[model samples]
Target: MRSVEKVGKTVNDAVTEALIELGASTEEVDIEIITKGSKGLLGFGARDAKVRVTLKAPAEVEPQIEVISEVKEDVKVANANKETETVAPPKSSKVKNKEKKDSEDAVVVTRDELAHVQALAEEFLYKLLREMNIEATVKSEVVNNNRLSIGFEGKSMGVVIGKRGETLDAIQYIVNIVANKGRTEYVKIMLDTENYRARREETLKKLAYKLSKKAQQSKKPIILEPMNPYDRRIIHSALQDSKIVKTHSEGKEPFRRVVITPNYQNKSYR
Candidate 1:
């Protein structure tokens, strides 16, 4: 039996590393924790967690042959000088078009479908806020197509908005799930309080313009801080008309960011 010590930011990470290195399953190894690492401030003097893994000893086995009944066989020709034919199934254009429509319906939400979903969403949110002891008037935006944008206006809306609109985002997430439930297609839902979304969009647009100018003037790329998908879309939309700059998103969720670069106007873009 061989043992290996691995270090990582956590005991689980260390165990993962050890398993990968030894190419063993969890059931095949015994793990020992060395240290529970500390998440130190600002990445200074951080102690990583450690684990020791030992491979389990193999069990001794006795080999025995089990007998299967044998039968005499009449041998047949093995496709020697034989001709084979495959018949193709008849194809219907209508069937293919119906399948394509089904797939598209699953992915694309229609305006009428969103209207119904948004109505349910608004009722759900109004009830939710009332239950929370925060009496708010919830209304759906009338202008949007294939998307639900709910507007909340209340006498006391500060608690609903929370710090940096975190609560609002949480509420929006729940309401989005409510809106899309039992639907075959996606219906995006957005919640706004005190026009927070519009304000946020304006801020992102300004930041995009500023960064675009900076990148163009300095001939360097600028990476913005990670934002949610909606905010990232706002940044891209803001820069869509920029003749001198372009935007791209990189990294994974929660840590994904927007990178801005100067376009130099000589290159064509879509």
Candidate 2:
């Protein structure tokens, strides 16, 4: 883990300074406020707040596939050292195995199509970022079944994420269109800059819980400010199973928002 110490007018200011230096979100760091500086006599004797922030270390990658070559070498040595002849499997069983292999190859993502989508996604995103005058390295990975994840690594996350990921969503929409155009099966594309989506989802989840509590206390509908469809979905999913409140989306696209209201059906019946 890497750590830093900063001084600012307030604790929040000091923490923000550390986060920028670390290029991390609030959830990714451990913060310690060494001193909560106070104002003393009209900014003359006022002391600046001091803080220590530590970032979590990245996870190590798992073991990998270079073992295949060693296995091949062992097989070659075994065949060379064998003194007895080996018998082949029956023709019928070989046919069955061939059929099984063909079936396995016919999954939702074909090898060729996966490669094509990965290339297209990376190129499209790189070009788009260049057009926006942002220097970013976009890498593509094939994930799950026929899904392409385009990950961005750069310092412009705040701009790319926008006020609430509106810009990111807009960019993903266009990238999806470019990737799936004229393709037979849709290859789902997810664009993220350094776990931004995961962090945003968590933030929205907490917001849902807080707003639900407010709605429960007041017994009044709480209309959240406007959000994009992606954010609205997060709110709805977060409160879908809440016992105290119900959630719904209202208004139209781009301006749509989530409404959280207290559940009153059982209360009314009682």
Candidate 3:
């Protein structure tokens, strides 16, 4: 990701200038505050605020496909050799339970219903944006036959994406409620502006790695600032495979935080 540094009257101004240079939004880049400028008395020692903004890396899809292809090849080889084997191993209980749960959770909806829900979600979003006096284009897509992904494009998205995306999340929550008001089978609705969701996920993953290293080096628990449940999940998943540290969340909603602790029992950490 490319990064740029800018100086302005305040941190927000510096970040805004940086974003304008990158042609990106606040959600699309990670901002680091370098200095909070001060307005000196009589303007003798005034200093401008400086900030560094870095564009986030794009999502990786090719690597996942390669991994899946390798797994399929292994499965094909196993199937080809099955005839010569005297016996085959049974599926694990975990696998069986998972399959059963998936079957029970699967809900079939007609094409008409899908279209209706999509239109409903889009209409509600348009009205909401109109009421907020923000003009933006709304696009919706069906993902995995069960989720609706909506994207927005326009100016002043920082208002829609409030601090840490609280505003965006609240919008999504209301949309979901309106869309599934009387439906027996619920469809998930996800909202994004300027690719905020993806960019935020990338930032959280990077933070997880950094904090994990800090915990391991210091041999102490590192508590992150409060994050929503969605963000906390990203942190936990990012560090789930680490050999030097473990992660978990503590506290109540809106104030819950993730804590990364060094795994002292692990030889690598010791």
Per-residue lDDT for 23-60 in model 2, tens only?
54444568899999999897689988999989765443
lDDT (tens digit, per residue) of candidate 1 on 36-110 = 898889988789899998888754211111110110010012123232111112244346556866664455666
TM-scores, all candidates, are: 0.53, 0.57, 0.63
lDDT of 3 by residue, 121-191 (tens): 99999999999999999999987676688999999999999756779999999999999889998887899
TM-score-based ranking, best first?
3, 2, 1
Instruction: For model 3, give the RMSD to the true fold.
Output: 15.2
* Model 1, residue pairs in steric clash: none
Whichever of 1 and 3 has more lDDT, that candidate is 3
Model 2 compared with the native: what TM-score? 0.57
Candidate 1 stretches with Cα past 4 Å from truth are 1-119, 141-146, 264-270
* lDDT score, candidate 3, position 240: 63
In model 3, residue pairs whose N, Cα or C atoms come closer than 3 Å (at least 3 residues apart or on different chains), thus clashing, are: none
The TM-score that candidate 3 achieves is 0.63
